[model samples]
Target: LAKTTQPISMDSYEGQEVNITCSHNNIATNDYITWYQQFPSQGPRFIIQGYKTKVTNEVASLFIPADRKSSTLSLPRVSLSDTAVYYCLVGDHGGDTGRRALTFGSGTRLQVQP
Candidate 1:
């Protein structure tokens, strides 16, 4: 597993775009970059994922540079409901045979001010 570093907090106005970046310089070859979003007490939900280049889903877009040392999660037109903690993880996805517990650290908290 690779260690990841992200911002502790960010402030954004309602209906504004927000981008959160995470660094993982020592990522392994089989490791994948995944982004998750959490609202208060709820469990984190998958936001986006990318090995390289850019990956866009309904909720967010993940941008990975060529070096694969870091990634950025882009949220368009964020609202108050989007205020939450975002986490970036770099690891191997254990489908069934390789199941493993996730190690979580302090994540980036985004505050949307109305």
Candidate 2:
């Protein structure tokens, strides 16, 4: 597992675009970057994942550089409900062979105001 670093906090207004970046300089070849969003008192929800290049979904887009040292989660037209703590995790998806460990950082708190 590679340790990740993210902004402690971010501010955005409704209908604005918010980009949160995570740094994982020690990432391994088998490692993948996964982003999650979580509200207060709730578990993290999967946003997107990528090994290299860019990946986009209905909710957000994940951009990873060729070196895989960093990734950015882009949320377009965010609303008040989109406010939450975003987490970036890096690990090898060691398939169903056995259990794997997941380490979480402090997470980036996104505040979406009106």
Candidate 3:
């Protein structure tokens, strides 16, 4: 398991693009980078995941470098509703082992202003 570091907080206005970067210095070969967003008193929602290169979905885009040390979560046209705690997790989720589970950190609080 690798420890991840993210911003403590971030601020953005409505309809602006926001990019949150997470650093994982000890990432493994079987590891995958996953991003999640959580609201107050709620479970984290899966946003995106990538093994390497880039991955894009309707919600967000994940960019990973060839070194596999860090990743960035890009949210386009964010609104106030997108404001929440974003978590960057790295693990191998292939089977039903304990590695499938995600460890939640303090997360980066995203504050979307009007």
Worst 10 residues of 3 by lDDT: 93-102
| Candidate 3 ranges with C-alpha deviation above 4 Å | 94-99
- Model 2, which residues run further than 4 Å from truth? 95-98
Q: Cα RMSD to native, each candidate?
A: 1.6, 1.1, 1.6
Model 3: how far residue 91 lies from native, Å: 0.5
TM-scores for the candidates = 0.92, 0.95, 0.93
**Residue 41 CA error for candidate 2 (Å)?**
1.6
What is the per-residue lDDT of model 1 for residues 13-96, given as tens digits with 9 covering 90 to 100? 988999999999998777789988899879899888789999998899999999999999999999999999999999876756
C-alpha displacement of 51 in model 2, angstroms?
A: 0.8
Model 3 lDDT tens row, 61-99: 999999999999999999999999999999886666654
Candidate 2 local lDDT, 4-34, one digit each (tens):
9999999999999999999999999989899
Give me the candidate number with maximum TM-score.
2
RMSD of 3: 1.6
Best-performing candidate as measured by lDDT: 2
Question: lDDT (CA) for every model shown?
Answer: 0.90, 0.94, 0.93
Write the candidate numbers in order of decreasing TM-score.
2, 3, 1
